[model samples]
Target: MRILIAQINPVVGNLKENKRKILEGIHAARENGCSLAVFPELALTGYPPEDILLLPQFIDEVKKELKEIAGATQGIAAIVGLPRANAKPFGKPLLNSAAVLFEGKILGFQDKTLLPSYDVFDEMRYFDRAEERRVFLLFGKKIAITICEDIWQHAALSKDVSYPLDPVAEYANQNIDLLINLSASPFSQMKAERRIHVVQKAAKTLKVPALLCNQVGGQDSLIFDGYSVVCDAGGRLVRLGNGFQEDYMVWDSEVKADELVAAFDKTEETYKALILGLKDYFGKQGFKKAVIGLSGGIDSALVACIAVEALGKENVLGVSMPSRYSSEGSVKDAVDLAEALGIELRHVPIEEPFQSFLDILSPEFKGKEPDVTEENIQARVRGVILMALSNKLGHIVLSTGNKSELAMGYSTLYGDLCGGLSVINDLTKRQVYQISRWINRERDIIPVSSLEKAPSAELRPNQKDSDSLPDYEIIDTVLEAYVHDHQSPDLIAKNHGYPKELVCDLIRRIHRSEYKRRQSPPGLRVTDRAFSIGRRFPIVQGWV
Candidate 1:
């Protein structure tokens, strides 16, 4: 039997378009004379439907789409993932399922056995754990199917006791010939290698062929990198699919397994993940154009370049929103950078809006002297103009704040924080500078002045980031220890050679800004623990 793994990127909630892709895959598999083809989990409605899963109408739409796909599977047998619902007695409705379709008929169904509820996943909120294991017979082979988290039960260890169930081990004892797992796993650096090791270990121990299919594309902050693989009963890889793209590969059951082909190089994989994330996030949302406030700083310059790369130069609009406090060199640098990227540049001075806001609020601010409040007003004015252009032109605004600023509460809530997406919110200030340098290494897309100039908000007459926060090098180290390493303030201070008081203040700011982050837009998650979805903190709590 020839089995095909269709590693595809489906737009979340775009039922019609997603169905088209699924059909296209089926056609390709049939042309290759494959008996069975498998797609990623939640292929119909996309993965992590989130609150959309709560709507009864949305669930109905998913079921309708599944039927349409089932009808298209005339000669080929396929397994597709979707949400299944049934009426509950004196409780919430049942919403869990997967479909096994062959010759336009539903052969069987498997509800996901495990519901993950931690760190950017809330599957338990909408789905109940399936009580039974499902096994299906196809092409003279007994096959067992499991969802993403189901196979990871062995790796999930508790401090005191072992897990009661091992899905792969149980299926191995049943004389199953093939183990197929579908996943919607998100991307982190080095995650592809870890996934391969796990699958190989499982195949070697079980002595059964294993097929792994994963979803690709960006959904909000999460970007799924599809590196699908097929391993033989001897734990040797037969074929590996492409990473960061939509690909389909067929593995013939008669062919012997071979050595594993190494996945994409590290930098190449990271770059592709960013590009795919940016492309699909905008494409799937029906956005054809994007707008950004180009401040002639490294952050905005890098974002503008990435936007031009993701969306064409014609679709990207770069705006220079200058204020009374803005430096002449910065404006020149912004124009130069836009020209370098061959993107259109527009100048929208914020002096009028800034003064108008001050005039309107002067009465309420009677005796209080101007401070960061004035600075925030300038930033908010720029935000308003960018948002106006975005609304008028039907373009999504991209916020350019990096993780370092976000961690220090150095950004204004509705000012720099206003946008449909935050591209580099997971990247620290140091990483931003490094990536910017990399962008300019081969070609000069970003102007050198932008990199050489001292980083500033340009919100006040002589505002520099150092006025409110420590230098980025020091601040980023503190943040990495606390946020990514989960170190306490005292521990971070001792380890990083920082003053205890400063470390404490930094942690306090991060904790206090939880509310602001909760309201911020979704960003691309490059790190293991990014803000917004992955990191959760209480807004009304006193615990440090």
Candidate 2:
């Protein structure tokens, strides 16, 4: 049987457009002489419709579109994900399901069995679990299909205990010829690797060829890397689709699986994901231009390069709001970097605004020394200037603060943190440098001075990041343990050989800055744990 994996990007609630894309893919499948075409989970309504699933009218519309799509599946069979109504009134009114279409008629649907509730997923709240498994015959072969989470029971998230009922496992010993899985799994660092392992294991367990098709595009903060994969029963890969973009591929059980899977590279994958995330966010949101506050630091420089790569140099505007404390080299570096990227650089001096704010607050700060308040005034001044530019020009601001700074409370709220999106907030300070160096490896995209110079906020005289916190080399190691690994301060310090006091203080700052992070713009999630929907921390909490 020839199967075409239609990896598509679907907009949420745009039923008409989604149907059009689905029909287009089906037509292409027929032209390619493929017997079947499969799309990602919730291909009709888009993945994780979130609260839209709660609306009864919305589900009805999706069903309406599904039937229409079913009618168009004439020459080639197509499987698509959509919201289906459950006749039983006891549970949730909807079931996350996929329908098989053949000869312009409905071949019925297979509801998702596993409803993931942990981390970013809340499927249990909206979708009812499947009662039993079913098989559909196509191309003279019996096929057992599973939804996204249905086949992820053995993933690392499951720890060691398997689900009470494995949907794919249930089909074992049934003599199934092929196993198909529909997925809309989001991008997390190394998540693609974990998915490949799951697909390989499932194929081996069932002793049949397996294929998985995932959605691609940026949905809010989540980015689905469409690396649709196919593997034979021997745990060998047959085909792997493109990453970070919508793509199409075919897999035939009769053909020999000789195509080599692409090698895994974390840095390369993350760079592409961030670009796609930013590009799709603007494209889907109807944004045409972007603005970035170029502080001339490595963080801002890296973010500028990424923005240029995503939106093009013409669409990106670099605003350099240098205050009195800003170094001459920093200002020059911002101009040079913008010139190198061939983007417009706006020089809006914030010195006057900084002085005005200090002059107004001098009376209120009668006895207080000129401390963080003065420094923050500079940052807020720069923020106001950049935002004003964005407001007038209709440009989305890309916040340049890295994950390390945000975690350490080293950034200003409504200041450097003010933007429509945070492109590098999920990346640590070290990661920012790593990608910067990687970009510069081809040529000098980022200024050499920015990399060699000590990292600074440039809000005060002789201000440096290391003056307040530990070195990024040390900070990232501790953060990886404390944040991603969920290890305690003591354990991180002991295991990673970090300074106990520094690690404890950093952890304390991370907890205290919860309110700040909660208000920050949506950031692209490159790591397993990002400061978005996936990582939920109470703003008011005690961690003594």
Candidate 3:
């Protein structure tokens, strides 16, 4: 039997466009003489429509689109996920469901059993869990189907991540030829390996072949990587789809899968995720150009490179807002970067505005010594300049702060934190350097001087990041342990070669910075624990 994996990028609430894409995939599968085509979870209304599920008109449109998609399944059978109204009167109004269409009609519906409730997910508020095990006959084989979280019930990524029920085990008890899951699982560093492992384990435990087809594209901060997979009965991967974009694949039961999926380095995956996230963010919003404040630092340099790559050099505007403390080398680096990338470089000095602000606030701070307040005024001047340029030219400002700075509360609010979207907010200082080196592996796209120089805000005289925080290596290591790895400061200090006092202080800063992060722009997610949606902390907590 030939089963086609239809990995489609669906925009939330675009009913007609989503239906057209679904039909396009099914027709392609039919032309290839495939028996069945599987689409991603929530293929109709798109993934995580949030509160739109509560609208009666939105639910009504979903039903209409479901019928329309079913009518197009004349020559092939297709599985497309949607929201189905619950029949019971006492539960949540909707079921996260999939419409099985074949022979020009809706054949059956499979509701999602396991609804994830943690991290970025709030499905418990919108969807009711399914109560039955569904085994359907498709292409002369008994196949058990599931939605995204149903299969993830086996993977222990979090505490009690699995549901009380087990869909894989239920199918394992019965005689079934194949297990299929439709998903809208998002992308993160090393997530592809995790997904492969879970699918292999489920297929092995159930003693049947398994296939997972995932959604692709970016929605806000969420990015769905379309690296779908097919594992044989022996628990080995046979077919794998492409990453970060839409793809179509066919799996034959009799034929063994090709070689194992190639390992993508962290930098490569991070690069692709950022590009896709930026592209969709711009395209979906009907904006073609982006304006970035390039400071000649690695963070800003990297964001400019990604902007040029995502929106093309002509669409990216690199504006250098130099302050009184700005070094000539730094400003020159920004100009050289723009020249190499073939993008327009506009020079805007914030010296006059900084002086004006200081003159106005001089009497209010007459007795106080010059401190971070004066430095912050300069930073905010640059922020105001960037915003003015964006306002006049209709370009979105791209912030350049990274995870380490964000974690340590080392950045100025309303200054460096100003942007429509943050390009590298999820990446740490060390991660930014790693990807920078990788970008220059073929040639020096990033200037060598920028990479070698000490990182600084350049707001005050000879200000370095090391003045407030530890080394990038130390900060990133301690941060991953506490923030991403979920270890306590004392425990991390004990297990790792770190000082307890330093660890405790850094953890305190992380907690204190929650207010700043809450106000920051949405960032692209590339790690398992991104600051945007994956990590949650109380801003006023003293538990640290």
Candidate 4:
């Protein structure tokens, strides 16, 4: 039997288009003489439909589309992920389900056994766990079908997941011929290896071939990398699908396949993930042009490069808003970067507006020394110029605040934080440099000066980032432990050999910046624990 894995990108809430994609995949699979075709979890309504799943009309529409999709499955069998209404009138009113369609009819659904409620996933809010596990016979082979988190019960591979039932393992003695998992797993650093390991373990446990069909494309802050997989019975990878985009592959049981080994470069993978995320964010929302405020700094430079790559240089516009504090080299770097990028460069000097603000606030600050308030005016003046361009030019402003600055409350809210989207808010200062250097590996794309220059906001004279915050090395280390790993300040300081007071102070800053983050634009999430939708913190909390 030949099984076609259809890794598709589905826009959430677009039932008609998603249905069309599924039908197209089924037709293609049938043309290839494949017996079975598989799609990713929640392929119909898209993964993590979120509050849309709460709408009865949306579920009803999905059912209508599923019926049509079932009727189209004449020459081939298909397993599609969708939301199934809970007829029992209990347990969340819906099931995260996979509908099995064969020969123009609807077969029984295999509901997702594990409803993940951590990090970016909140499926338990809208879905109920599967009551039982079952094996189905398709093309004379007994197969166990699982949904995203259902097959993630492997002990060593599970990331903080604790489930009572192992859905795939339940069919251990049932003589299953294949184990299939339909996934909408989001992309994070090193997630592909973990996924490969999971499928390998499942194939070995079942002693049968295993396949995974993952969803692709970006949905809000989440980017589903479609690196689908197929593993042979001995737990070796046979087929690997495309990464960071939609793909399709067929695995034939009769044809012997060899293991395909691959290595993932962290920097390259992250760059691709960000590119996809940016592309989809703009494309899905009907955004055609992007306007970035280039400060001759690393953050804005990186965002501009990514925007140019994702949306084309024609669609990307760079504006250099120079102030009194901005250095001549900084302004020159912006011009050189934009010229090299082949994008339209507009010089919008904020010096006039900045001086105006300082003059106006002179009376209010009569006796007060020039402090962060005066510095913030410069940032806010730049922000106003960017917003005005965005308003007049029909382009989205891309904010260029990195994660380290965002974490330590180093950014000025309503100033540098003003944008429709934050491109690198998830990447730390260290990662920003890493990716910037990687971009310049072959040639100088992201200006070597931008990479080597001291990090600064240029809000005032000689305002290096290190003057206010710790070194990028120390900050990134603490952020990885405190923010992502959820380690305590004392433990982080002890483990990383940092001063306890410094660590504690950094943690406090992160907590105090909750209000700023809350107001910041939604950024592309490349990390497991981004400051986006998943990591919830209270702005008024005193927990720190």
Q: How much is 435 displaced in model 1, in angstroms? A: 1.9
Q: For model 1, how big is the CA root-mean-square deviation?
A: 2.6
Model 3: lDDT equals 0.88
Q: Across residues 1-544, which tens digit of lDDT does each residue of candidate 1 receive? A: 7988999998877889888988888888999999988999999889877788888898888888888888988988999888878545533355556689999988978877777777677787788776677789988888888888776675443122344677777776788888888889888777787777667777887788887899988887889999887888887877778888889989888877667766555555665677777888898777889999999899998788778888899999999999888899899999999899889999999888889989999999999999989989988888888899998999899999888988877888889999999988888888888777777888877888888888998887787888888888988998889988788888988898899999998888888878878777788987777995767777899787
Compare the candidates by TM-score and give the number of the best one: 4
Question: In candidate 4, which residue ranges exceed 4 Å CA deviation?
Answer: none
Worst 10 residues of 2 by lDDT: 154-163
Off by over 4 Å in 2: 155-157, 160-162
* TM-scores, one per candidate: 0.92, 0.98, 0.98, 0.99
Error of 3 at 334 (Å): 0.6
For 1-544, candidate 2 gives per-residue lDDT tens digits of 9988999999888888889989989988888889999999999988879998888899888878888888988778999988888888799888998898998899888999988887778888888999978999988999998999888884535542356877877898799999999999999878888888889989999989888999999888889999998989887987999998788797778888785666878888899999999998899888979999888889889888888889999999998888888899999899999999999998888878778888898899999888888888888887888888889999988898889988888889989999999998999988888888989998897999999999888777898888888888888888788888898888888887867898888788888988899989999888878876678888876654
RMSD of 4: 1.0
lDDT pick, better of 2 and 3 = 3
Clashing pairs in 4: none
Measured with C-alpha atoms, the lDDT of residue 217 in candidate 2 is 94
- Candidate 1's C-alpha runs over 4 A off are 86-92, 155-164, 263-268, 359-367
- Write model 4 residue lDDT over 272-362, tens digit each, in one string: 9999999999998899899999989999999999999899999999999888888998999999999989999999898788888888878
- List, residue by residue over 1-544, the lDDT tens digit for candidate 3: 8988999999998999999999889888988888898999998888879998999999998898888888888878999989989989978999998788898898888898988887778898988989887888887888889898888777555563756677888787789999899999998887888889889988899889999999999999988888998899988888899998889898878776565855878788889899999999899889999999989989999998899889999999998998889999999899989988999999988888888888898899989999999888888888888898889999999989999999998888999899899989999998899999999999988899999999989988888988877998888989999887789877999987888998888888888999999999999888878898867788887587
